[model samples]
Target: MNKFEIFTNELLKWNKTHKLTNYNEDEIKKQIEDSLYPLEKIKDSKTAIDIGTGAGFPGLILAIAMPNTKWYLVEPLKKRYSFLNYIKTILNLKNVEVIRDRVEKANLPKVDLITSRAVMKTNDILKIIKPFLKKDSTILLYKGSNVLDELQDIDASIISRGNRNYLFIKGEKWAK
Candidate 1:
């Protein structure tokens, strides 16, 4: 089966009970494509932290695509984390680790890449992930079209493509 089919099948199995995502096939395709756009920035990253990974949008997809990199999926909900673990086991994904805790509570190791989808407002997310991001880390936040206007007041460099937004808001220690 193709990757999309496999992804859908796995996601459907989780969605039967968890309401993971409402995206249809085309939407799912778009999400997956958008999730991968940051690969170029995080290519050399040894580890990545995915905050608020509900049902693993960019996290799981990125973990699957980049088997060589370590992925940490940080979610606060117990049931969601359970489902994420189940998916990891079912898919035999070794590089992915699901952390059942909020971004604030989780003991995050320094990572080169930090990513999230539908987690929080652009400004809020920068605060949420401030602790885990390293000096030169790149944050890839997947957002809808509404993000362009949201980026205006934010104190960070941002790139918007279609409905996706990549935030270059490095840790405070880094000189941007």
Candidate 2:
């Protein structure tokens, strides 16, 4: 099996014990596809962070796919943190690190990109990651059909990519 397949198998196995994912097998497959859609946009980024990385949707998968980019998977829960670290070791993923603290509490350096899925609304997410973003940093949010409505009030330029979207807003654009 490929690395993704192996990762999925392990995820499912862990799911049975920890209820890690809300997706079924088919849904999980689709989620993987959705998770990878932002790869092209984030390809040039030197550093990225996945906030609230529950079950490692785009973070772990992205780390596996892009070995050269440094990735930080921030998950506050102990169980999830342990699971991510376990997978990181199992896959021998050297590009990723697991942060066991909330985004606000973690002492993280500014990154080129920030990503999240099923975490929070667009505005809320933007607010949460603002302090950790640099001038040119990009935020990729994996959202559903309500993406348009979610971004309606936000000032950022939204670029649609399949089921995912990128919010291009500089630090100054953020409403304080």
Measured by TM-score, the strongest candidate is 2
- Candidate 1: where is the Cα deviation over 4 Å? 2-4, 152-155, 172-176
Candidate 2 matches the true fold with a TM-score of: 0.88
User: Which digits, one per residue and each the tens of the lDDT, describe model 2 over residues 28-113?
Assistant: 88878877876776788889899988888888888888888899999999889999999999999998989999987888888888
Residue-level error in angstroms, candidate 2, position 68: 0.8
Alpha-carbon deviation at 81 in model 1, angstroms: 1.4
C-alpha lDDT values of all predictions = 0.78, 0.82
Candidate 2 global lDDT: 0.82
* Model 1 weakest 10-residue run by lDDT: 167-176
